[model samples]
Target chain A: MRIERELMRGAGPVAVLKLLERHEMYGYELIDALSKRSEGVLALGQSTLYPMLYNMEAKGLIESTERAAPSGRERRYYRLTRTGHAQLAQQTEQWVAISRAMLALGILPGPTTTQEALA
Target chain B: MTTTAPQHESPPAPQRLWSDILTTPVGDLLRGRIGARCRPRPRDLIATCGLPAELASLVWEVVRRTRLWSTEKVAVSRELIAHFEDGLAVGTSAAELGVSFGDPAQAAALIRRAKRRNRPLIWKAAKLAENAVAAVLSLALLLYTIQVVRLYSHAPNITRNYVSEWNQDALTVPPAERAWPVYLAAMQATNGYWEHNWHGDELSPGSSSWPDITEFINSNGRALELYRQAAAMPKIGLVLGREPDVDYMVNNAGQPIKNAGAAPDPNPEFISVLLPPLTTFRSVSGMLKVDVYLAAQAGDAQRTQHNLDAVFGIVAHAREVRLMLADLVALTIAGDACRTIGALLRANPQLFDDHQLAQIAHRLAGLGGPEGLRTRFASERATVEDFLQRYFTDDGHGDGLGRPELLARLAVFTSGDPAPTRWTPTIGLNTVLMPAISPFMAGKREMLAKCLDFFGRYEAEAATPLWQRSPTTVDDEFIQFRTSLRNEVRYAPLMILMPSLGRAGLMYEYFAQQRDATTAALALALYHRQHGSWPQSLNELVPQLLPQVPPDRYDGQPLKYCLVDGHPLLYSIGVNRKDDGGRLPSPPPDGTKTPLAELNRQARRWQPAPTAQRGAGAAMEKPLPDGDWLLWPPVE
Candidate 1:
């Protein structure tokens, strides 16, 4: 199922930052990777994703540069900045804690192993 | 995943119209400024690609609706096109991609907000300033409209007629006892010949103008007799608009009445009520001086005393007007009479007996008695209050706003230029605009208070003796008080109504000194007659020939006295406030001392020099000439 808008608003930037933390990605590449990896649950529209990237860049959480792809088409690439990396680490910890609390209250299914739940 | 041909889902006309609106001149100027950093136009790669017309049109629609910087629109367009193209390669249908893109308006708004946040700091500040200016202009326009309504609704209520009130005493005088008619006849019979011929010099036998002087005396014998008869009367009894007599009206009304057929309005506005011109009185006093000099030359002490009495009468008549200007004229006439007395005593010392000398001295001593030297500001205050009433609206609590139409009327009256009989477009425009601006000016109560405060301070300062007063007192205070930008705007009516009385105060002091010196000289003359020699000092003449020694008005000291060349020399430490051992101002290059009459002229013309700096720069500066003012032996 698709995430609710408010939850997506919180999750979207962290997801993008996590992807960019691995390697720089253009707009289309990031969208494709997010859909496949999150099984379309964390998917964002072209309308929402571009503005989100622009806002993150404005806040210095991400930076963008224009470059030519191997296909000879000009594309904009985004990457995590030092601030973005720190924000991702902090948000990841918060998400982990939230999952643990949900499991303790039986709102989420208990993990088969503690390691599985943490992962 | 498989690709399908793009579906033509949305209409094309609306998008084209929106695009056309953004390219207008004003829009283009704004866009160029907002997009200043977006240089080297980006190629529309989506147009070159094999994208369906529907998909390409959608991308252009969203970009156009954003209304962002051109560079930002291009970037957004490129990214969206690439996202769609990538989706197609991944087997997403074009119709499904369009549905996922959501509303074009919402997307444009979101992108626009985010993009604006990334704009340069100067651009953001400029946009803020543009909004602020618009808000301020709107507020100012609203306030102006409110003020316009307020000013037009209110009008001045003139309850009291100040002119009739001012004339009450003069109107109550019995016609039989009135001296004004005799004075008027004297003025008519005098023929105004002295006014045209005399160049403001003493008309003694020694004067260069003595030929005209003899003719003037011979021709105006009847006029001189009338003047003496008027002088001997108990009351001046001058009333305004009582008769249509031209010279009488001109003397008391300042100007001839325009509509002579109509009786003077009993309750006329105060400003329109003319004050008596001092010129006629001053001219008559001047003629009387000539009469006194001629009598003294003939050694006729009785004629001299009668003529002197006429001069004093004219002074009292002028003083009765109760105006600062009239009082100044009175002092001036008194001073001229004193100087004439001094000249007579010096030239013809044997002209009068001991009794005649004592009488002359007593009359001179009383010329400007204690209250005479004080400039009265009551009439002046009344005039300003009357002006304020006419110039502003009264709300009964003594507070009200200015009425610009009345101000314009006052301007026309005081300017001495006749106002236009017919209204023109310029007058109409002034009528419209004056009310709009008058609300920002001083209201009646504040203006009255300011005027009273200024007059109060000035009168208090003037009451003190010259030596006790500050160096830069009345005139300096007036200049500083009136010329400030804030005061000029707020107290404009007060500025217009108030006369410059500072110099009038100084002039009163000068004339007071002249009167005192003449009294002491007359006393000395009497003592010389009795003792056959000048006294050892001015003290010997006191209580016998004089009541008390008159102090030098310049420094508040006893008048300087000494025997020079075995003749009594009398003088005052002058404006410099230093004793120069009774030495006079340096003589002319010919080594002849300036005649006392010439010295008197110089004294009247004197003005204080600017104060010098107190430190080292003062030493390098040229100092003002320090001289004693010679009063006795007549400087000749």
Candidate 2:
């Protein structure tokens, strides 16, 4: 759980950047894509999503273009700029090593077989 | 049964959270709870502060209620709750709600919305939201919309209460410093007017208008003192008719000519009469409004037909000054309320341009209009005092005493050159024609015959008239109209001080807009010059602010002002015009029409801060009353 918190807390900005790395996505699609990838483990608020995306865009971490939804509603399409992709790569490697150290710990004496890998 | 989909598990009882939030502003507290997990939109920034504050409260109520009725119960995240529950309720209230529904979160939120919405005020609020939701839901219904159901309403009661609270002393006559100097002075002048009339000479009221303003200072002197003592009253003004109080016919000796019976002389009727109090001499006003009709259904067929035909004739053969639609534009401009309506007319042309149209527009302009005048039935005005001092010594007639013609003798006391500049004793004996004179013009006549006419009218009644008409005219229609408006307005008389102020108040606006940011720099400098002390009003910096502040243009009245921090506020009680927005010399905090403190209160209603201050206004939506305006930033 502690490992999950650490990874999830900083993972939002990095994960948002990763989704935008290939192509731009609207808020609804961005949430859906991330949910599918994380298998519902990370559930970020749709409300909080825009301000962060907009703040990063202001900071030049990403670039955005306005697109019309199929219903003709205006939506902001967010894409990772060069700096955003670079930051995402750096954050991904750091989180991978830390996540490895946590899962490697084996239970000392459990009723279950120790030779079996933890589900 | 109404079908509602159970979207999520019921939430735990949020009673503890709700109670904690009771002390805080409900808007903020509710937003924290309900606004979570929803699309982020600007909430507090553009909140419509319209009528019925409960609408906002209801929205928050519904949101918080929904959250509590959900299945989350005790599992509700702290981030989702805007307000904090006390330690006691953290365990109990949540458990109670959780026990009700298998899903504590869903049930808690639903119960909260339903419970808070139990009142009639919330039912209206739900209707408000439902309408907006309907607009987005059904385009067909939205297409034919003439007006939308709105949560915020501009209530007559709120403004009425505001005006009444400020107008507590509207009719109070304050005590004078020297005990009604103008009344004393007018009495002395009457003696001179009497003696001259007997000598077949005339008297003209010179410089009486200046004394005319004394009633404002005198009549309300005691009330003002009380106000000053209590420190609770705002500035309310009194009108003095702007003309001399007593008109008289006099003899050659510049004294009024009285009969041997010591009554009014019948020859030319030489006598002094006090005209009705001055409040009636003020101008009238109108406002802007509209009504839509399915068709021109005439109210009265005869009158309607006459009105229609009159319009056609007027348009067909209109002459110079024949009253056209343009006249309304001119009247609106003259009234100084042209900005809003003028812009509307400029936008659409197909809606109007005929005589009947202008007439209807003029009628609408007076919809919910303000009264034409205030302070009616002023019979007890200090200016009409009844005290008289009489003395008889020697007549200097025949007993070997030298005597001259009345005019020649009165002239000895008042006249020197062919055109005299000082007070003269020589006057006429005629006083019978006074009733023919206009009371406002009694002081301006030069003929010996006219002086007789001026003094003839004294006991004229000024029982209040219609809002648009008063002071009794040949056509009593204005009287009836003015009365109807007064009845309909059903508010305080403070509204009458707006329009005349609307015109004269331009001086301060001019000063505010002066190129130097000059007022600002000067205010800042003065604030610093005073050793960081604040001055009470702009008058302290009059010669400092400008060469001299100008009198009002509508009626040559002087402007009043006050200062807060370093910026100056300028105002004038409009003469029976409803544009000053009820700004007065001294306004209470809760008074309507957005006086200075109220402006600040409106600006800082949510968050209290030192920088939260008042000006004429910080923006357009917050416009200050015409006379009751302030400079934006305090200088220095």
Candidate 3:
């Protein structure tokens, strides 16, 4: 099921910045990586993804440069700045605590409990 | 719970106005649109990503579907097409790849929102500044319009107010006898006879006018007696007539009394009434000249000194009434009398007492102040203000354009009919546009005040160096101010009426220099009379003969004094302000041909027909070189 827009709003930039933290990525590459890494739970549309990336770039959380890709086609590559790295670390910690709280309330399965529940 | 993406149902899309106003891309902004070559051109787009015909058509379709500004559309199309090409390489169908990126309509809305957030702070600030400037300009224009309207509404009262405040009734004729023709004829005859003989330097009975003025005085002793009584009268006390037209004046035969020359002109009709009082002063002065001449002929110094005192008394009265032009005439008459006194002393040396010499020095010092000329210019400003205010408010009634009562008092003379002098508001021009044009008068008024201020300063520091004096520098500043003021708006019409306003200032410089020379020369003569020899320097005349050495108004130094061949020689530094070691500069070429009074009359001729500049050297507001204006005690 697709997540509600409000639920994804707060998490989008941190997820994008975290992905860019791994390596520089273009628009389509970032979209594919986000969907695979989150197992489709955080999959975003191309229309939403590009605008969010532009907003981050405008805010200077990320920066973009145009260069030739492996396919010998020009593509805009976005990368995280130092500020983005710090933001991503803080967002990761907040999400982890949230997950732990959800586990205690039995809303989310804990890491060890998740494999047993599936069996 | 149904979780299979809600088993999608097809829905119609929303449409919005595709305004391209906000879509300036970052690249176009950076390169400043003029340098937009750095942005991806359409050819760059096609060459970078080789697409099939259908794919190329789809890319153009997507761009056309969006509401982006031209440059932003090109950038978006090129990037998205390349993304599609990448998808095609991954084995996705073209149509499926296009759908995979999402709806074009949704992308347009999101991009527009993103661009809004990305606007620069500086652009917003610049927009705010532009609005502020527009508001200020509008407010200034509004205030200027209000001021012009107020000036027009209140103009009629300024003259009445100034007249009442200054008590100008003392300078006019009485109303009960205003229409008497005999009085008008006598005034016309007075002006005609005065103009007839005014050019001559020597006012003896045989010279200037042998039979006309001298015979008229001998035959019409009653007229001369009337003038003598009027001169001794404490106040001017003539009531100004506020008649409607120039035809208000008539001769004893009930015919119109035209002006003094060939034709019976009525142009100076307003000043005609004012001239009678001046005529009284002239008569008194003419009689004084006669008394001095006859006294000197008999070698009678006491009678000459008595007549000279009476001339000085009339001069003081003229100055007191603020009749500048009249006062100047009185001073000239006094100068002639003083010359007669010097002649008497020289013809028979030791002819006068020391007390008589001291009294002569004291009277000359009284006439030396620059106040009379200053008051004259002040009255001119008031009159001009009255004239313009009257001209502007001429609302075309019985008393409006056709008949202005102000012309009954303030006379204007030119060769032609004075009908064109009436300035009316034209339909599309002056009526609507005069509000924008009238504020320039404020600048004109300010410059006039500066001219008056220069007179005050020249009087106060009449002994300062030429380099330190303010006339030339103030004149330079006035030219600059006037040029810039003229460029702001065309005020050619009002300028027609008062073209001499700019050069009226130079009159003060002339009068000041003349008065200073007379005072210094009188003091020098007094010194010679007391010491039995000429004083070596002006300092020897101080404390008793003169309170202080009189200053040369031109160079602002003590009047140059030297004894050449045992005679006292006194002179101003002239306009050049250099001491030629008491040597007078050669006079102007025209000086010998035309008498000083005739040249002055030519200068006073109503200046350039109101259609041209008043004088050729009108722009030269600096002092004119007219020799050292020597005071050599009329050679022994």
Candidate 4:
């Protein structure tokens, strides 16, 4: 199922920042990782994904550089800035609070709040 | 796990001038509705994948619509195309790949919206500036319409009738009619900046401007021609253009008009008042020097006599105009002219006949009196008083400041708006706004009156002999009054106050000295003619020649005079008002001081040892102090 636009917009930069924190990822690889990690829930289209990355880069949350991957094809790898790490930490706490509020309202289940479920 | 470190990094952006901010590419992009779409590039469509033609075209269209920088465009394009290729590698059909990316148009719109939000800081600033300028211009236009209605709606009959009465009085006299036009025309033609570079090196080895002096003679010819005409006129008055500025359009040419308050439309960004008169004075002075040189060369005695008469007439015109306008700088120009003519006569003493020399002495005696300067000072006060009475009430509330016309005109002037631009109407709107907020309107009439009073008091004080006048006391009061008005906008209406107002007294002082010195020099010339020898003292010429000796205005003492090797030397006590025992300083190497300093007491003032002065090409020594007011005769 496709994610709603407003929900995707709020979580987009935070998700990108979280992925870049572990290791630099090209655009296509990030799309795949986000799909697999979120169980296809946050699978952004190719068009949506590139523009999102651009917005994050412009905000200084992530920076991009082109390099030859191990597959001998050129790919743009994005890495998190110091600002991105701080932003991720802040957004994660807000999202946790939001999930707790939704759970108290019985809108979301308690199982989804766990780290493994989140991953 | 590719390392983040990458090689071949692009160079950092170069520094741009602040002026380049508006002209940059991003400045253009952000100033639109959704910003212009980026141009479609062929490279985006030329991907290696053997994808379906229609799918490739759709993807290309989407990327082209996004207004990203070239590098950003390439990254977006390649990644999207790579996603498609990955789908195909997973055996996904063309339709499935298209569905995965969503509708092409929707994707393009999302990217565009994102681009707008992520603009560079400079681009954002430029957009803000553009919007601000647009808002200001719109508000200015609205205010401008209100101002125009305010100015034209009210028929200020009191001011109009007052101006008409003054105009009628102006119609009765032809003030300096003959000389005024010629002087203006000559001024327009020959006048230029008196900067040092304009004249070049006066003592250059083979300078051509000296001998022919064609430019000098031609300009003088115009002034002299005008002078002769004015001298021949039956009568001449001191009145010129007057107040409200409309009289110039209504009155006949050559008629004198009463000067009134500031006009609604003054000559916008006009040349300074000091420039026209000072430049004209310099032109006339330069002519006097050149005429004397030419007369000396041709041995044209008649021409020299005409030149002397022309100098007197032109200088008289200058004095009258300057006094009428209360222009202090013109007084200095008058002094400069007198000195130049004096030097000319002293250098070519033989050029004048005995009778002509006596007449010169007589003329000098007549012009030396300070009656004209005093009269002009009083006249300026009366004019300002009239303006205050007619335009303002007893409590200082009247139309001159309260009117929209003056306010608008002043705004135009202060805004530095080009006089002919669309902003002219808007500039006037400032007057409407100013009265509401500006502290100047409270007692603006009194402030103007005070400004005029300062000029009047200082000018009258200037006439007092240097010994009796306390310059520091006068200056202290002036400084105190000015400091009280500091940063106050009300006094801005007194914009007619020239920079030369305070310093004009010095010019008057110099004029007095020049007059006294010229009189003494002429008297000496006459005595020499009668006795065939220099007088023993100025007293020798007292009863028969001079009536009485002229005293230096500096210290109210008899002007210092001496006969050095049979050449007459004369000077005042100068600004310092000290007698340096008739001493003169030596000439500077650059020849700024005329070589005339080498003659008279200057010879002994410096390098007292006469024997040490003798050498093989010793070169001109630096000049000594000439007791400040040195105008000794050249060896000639």
Candidate 5:
């Protein structure tokens, strides 16, 4: 639910970019990573993931290869091109600046009293 | 996630649109607490017993009480059968119900459902139709489906939901409908006539002169008779032929009239064509019944356009498939005829040396050459003929007629004077127009190639500064590029032939208009008279009013309807997706050209039919032979 709320707040596009920053991966692995890293909290669906992947790929922010694996399963893997890395760097800088401003105003909530809860 | 994408899906279930039905008042009655079998007071019965088929639907209407129940008649009958078998009747108590006819338990009723084999009739038929393991069985099944059951375009919206709901039922429609026997009888008569007529005229290939006319009257006449019989067959294999058959037959002789003493035999050899005399119609019928049960089970589980399309396409193709067979028969006959003539020459004394036949042999080898349809064998045919003529004269066996004169004379004997009757079918060897057959056994491959070539050429012509075929200035509202005599000629006589589908199309056009008050009113009258009250559905009046119920072309679903006190309303949501009953639809939906059934009384008095009127109802059903394809009445 929180992930869905975050998605509504435009975190989805940014989260996808961040995932691309980490490594090139297929929709399934990307879904798996989102679920694992968020401890299963990032409730992304294949439908949403595919359309976003397609949009990003079309926009040239990331590159992908639709090929069969040695395992014989066909998967489309995404790779973080230099353009994706550059976009990620720029996005990260803005996030850092916003966090600092929020902290200076004492508007930031205290860190949640819990473990990362990674899957 | 693994996508469970099976290659084939089950047939569509438009009748099980429970939600859509529930929207109708009749839905409440059928699904209400009164039970699947409901008792209605005698005051509700309006006995119009003349039309029994319509009356049957009316009985359901009074029982269901709603004018629109999505259930097929077969479904209702199955429910009735189950109710009666369980010793249950429609009424609650003696006071609440009266046996005006007879006790429901003891009532003589025909069960519309397939006889519960409760066993797999054929375990093989029960398998998914994706693989080729059942190719032969499936081909025959496809042929059978073509004969009786017709597939129509359906509303895709309720297909999935409808199938799911209907699948829950205990009984489903069998392979053939209840009236199938009568329909089949009609078709069988036509088919028998053709076979009997063929036997009557005893003619064989290469017999003699009058033998050809005898063959023509026997073989060709039988073929015509066979075509005529097609119309009487069931809706399953209704063939929609293209226009232009007479012109094709009148001029271009389909058979090889002038062979170089060698031509292929006419009949095609199907290795698995043999069947036992013990193979009774009932046996085939039983297998089909099982197939339908299996198909129904599939309908319950899944619904997809591809599934229904396959059924309909297979049905359509079954009748139309004869054209493909025609091509096959033509090829084999031509080839065999050529071969036979060539062999005859080789037996004779030295006639232009053996190379004449040898050269023709090279051309025949190209039957497997890159193309798929082999037509046009001119030069090889010519060379062989010239050699034979020279030999006959050199040996003093010439029929007093000289070589050129003889060749010309021979042409007259076969085709007639001046205009040659013996023109060659374009074999792949001589003409670039016809493609080689072996490599591409499928016929459409060459036609597709020709289409692609023409597309590019036409595009170039279109790009020209001015029209070349003729002049048509932008200011002048005029047409250009008339059809050339040769250009207009079609190769196959059967391919171009279409009967007078004229009035049927007119009726169809009128039906497409929702505002035909006469049609709507007539439909309502028929409904009221039959059900003792207004009927709830178009189906309630099928056999009585329309010969058959027409499916909506838009989504291939049954046309939508609602019921009133004494009338059932039929209408299609026009192309605009707005209900137009049967009037002019706006910017029509892409391919949704529905001949929307209106209330039978609403038809306009003088609206001219656009094409041929093919309106829904008992207007007229083309009669058929015993078990043949459905054909239209022959065109003038």
Candidate 6:
């Protein structure tokens, strides 16, 4: 199931920063990872992903450089800057708190066992 | 349930007119030239990808719609092509890829906005400044257009004819009482020989030009007789009509009539309506002076008295005009008469009998009295009021904005140049600027108040005695006020209209002293003729030779009297207010100068020390001379 457009707009930049925080990624890699990791709920088309990347780059949240891939194709890769790393950390905290509140309100499923909690 | 992602769709065919135009051969050539100039080495990765023609065209359409800076457009093009290539690398069909890409127009707009945000700060600031300048220029143009419309839509309503009102009093005087016709006749009877031949000091019997003087008097007997008859007339009654311009009549005509037949101007501009010229009256005074000197030289006391009376009559006639300039001319004529009388008494002591001397003394004593010494500017105030009405729009409450066209005309008029017969660059420039300047200028009511305030101060200052008046008075105040940059803009019209009256005020005082001193000298001449010797003091002549001793105008003290080399000397303490004990200024170290007027100017302390010199410990470059103003025996 896809999230609503308004929810996606709020979630988009933070998700891109989190992905770029781990390592540098290209546009197709980011889109594929977001789709699989979120069970297709965060799936974005080329049009949406490219514009989001450009906006992040403009805001100094991420930087891009064109380089040769292992397959010998020239691809523009994006990486999180220091500012993006901080932003990702902040957004992660906000999401964890929101999930806790949802769980408390019985809107989200609580952990079923001790193992689940530990995980 | 699963939802399909949005597809990147091209614009409908009917909305693709711009795209169609760009595909034309000429458009293609222009595009090629622009592309070479803007993106000299653009990368085309789509061509290498071997993508289908449809997919390739989609990438180009998306990039073209961005409409960003050339460099930014090229960057967007490269990135989009790279993204598509990566999609195709994953074994995705061209159709599936195209379906998921979304609207090209929306993407182009987003990319363009984002790219602009990333531009260098200098470029952003420059763009902002460019936009701001365009906005301000548009606003200014709009405002200027509105102002021009406002200026042109309204017209000045000149309800009053000031010229007719000014001529009303003169017109009421009966023709029989009018002296102008007789004066004109006197002017016509003269041969113009006296005007051409007479120079300064020529009226003196001892002057080298005495021959010319005798001939002038001998030849113009009828003119002299007419002058005497005109002097006896009850009133000047010179009606200044509309036509035959005053200057033309006075300066050009052989016999300028008192009233030209032209009707009064129905619509007259006050400043443009010339005041009746006093040049003819001034000439009459000059001719009468020559007559006085010659008659006195011939020892004919009766003819001398007649000429003196005519000269005084001309002075009285000039005063009736009520103009400050005319008043000044009248004062000058009176001063000349006084000087001629003093010279006559000194040159020919036996020429006049006791009764004749008493008559001359009385006339000199009553020349201006206390009232004439004060400069009158009532007519000047009226002229300014009239000008304000004609030049400004009437809002029915005595307040209105200046009409730009009339203000421009005034500027041209005051420049002392005749109005341009055709459009010139200067007039064109004035036309353009007048509207812009009109908003900043003072309105009619405010200008009138300022004018009244200035005239009021001037009249007050004129009323004060010279000895009691402050050095930094109306003249200095006006100079400082008018010359300031801000005031010059606010009072632009006033700066053009107001004549300088400070020097004229000083002249009035100077001539008043001359008249008084001449009166005293005439009395002294009478005292000597009776007693066979000069009086020991000016007080000795009181109630017999003089009703009372004339006070010094510079310092309210009685006129200084002393015997110099067995002759009676009379003088006043000059502007420095110091008594040099009836001593004249020493002759120039170089030699004697011929012109007595120049000598008198050099001898008299006409002005006090400058303000800068009056400050504590300020050393003057050359100190002003401390000299007594020698009034008699006429400063020979």
TM-score of chain A of each: 0.90, 0.73, 0.86, 0.88, 0.75, 0.88
TM-score of each model, in listed order: 0.80, 0.17, 0.49, 0.48, 0.17, 0.84
Q: Which predicted model would earn the best lDDT? A: 6
Of 1 and 5, which scores higher on DockQ?
A: 1
Worst 10 residues of 6 chain B by lDDT: B37-46
Q: Which prediction has the highest TM-score against the true structure?
A: 6
In the range A66-103, model 2's lDDT, one tens digit per residue, is 54557554455778888888888888888765554444
Winner by TM-score between candidate 3 and candidate 1: 1
- Rank by DockQ (best first): 1, 6, 3, 4, 2, 5
Tens digit per residue, CA lDDT, model 4, A51-95: 787778778888878767676655678899998899999999999
> Candidate 5 residues B298-337, lDDT tens each?
4421221122222222222222222223223333322222
In order, what lDDT does every prediction score? 0.73, 0.32, 0.54, 0.56, 0.33, 0.74
Better of 1 and 4 by TM-score: 1
Worst 10 residues of 1 chain B by lDDT: B607-616
The parts of candidate 5 lying over 4 Å away from their true place are A1-119, B1-449, B452-559, B564-569, B573-579, B582-636
Better of 1 and 5 by TM-score: 1
Residue B138 C-alpha lDDT in model 1 = 88
Superposed on the true chain A, the predicted chain A of model 6 yields a TM-score of 0.88
**Tens-place lDDT digits, model 3, residues B180-250:** 22223344344234433444354654574544555554554454344444444444443323221222232
* Weakest lDDT window of 10 consecutive positions for candidate 2 chain B: B282-291
Q: What is the lDDT of residue B75 in candidate 6?
A: 72
Question: Is candidate 2 or 5 superior in lDDT?
Answer: 5
Pairs in steric clash, model 3? B172-B238, B172-B239, B173-B239, B463-B556, B463-B557, B464-B556
lDDT of 5 at B293: 27
Note the DockQ of each predicted structure.
0.60, 0.01, 0.48, 0.33, 0.00, 0.57
lDDT of 5: 0.33
How far in Å is the alpha carbon of B239 misplaced in model 1? 5.1
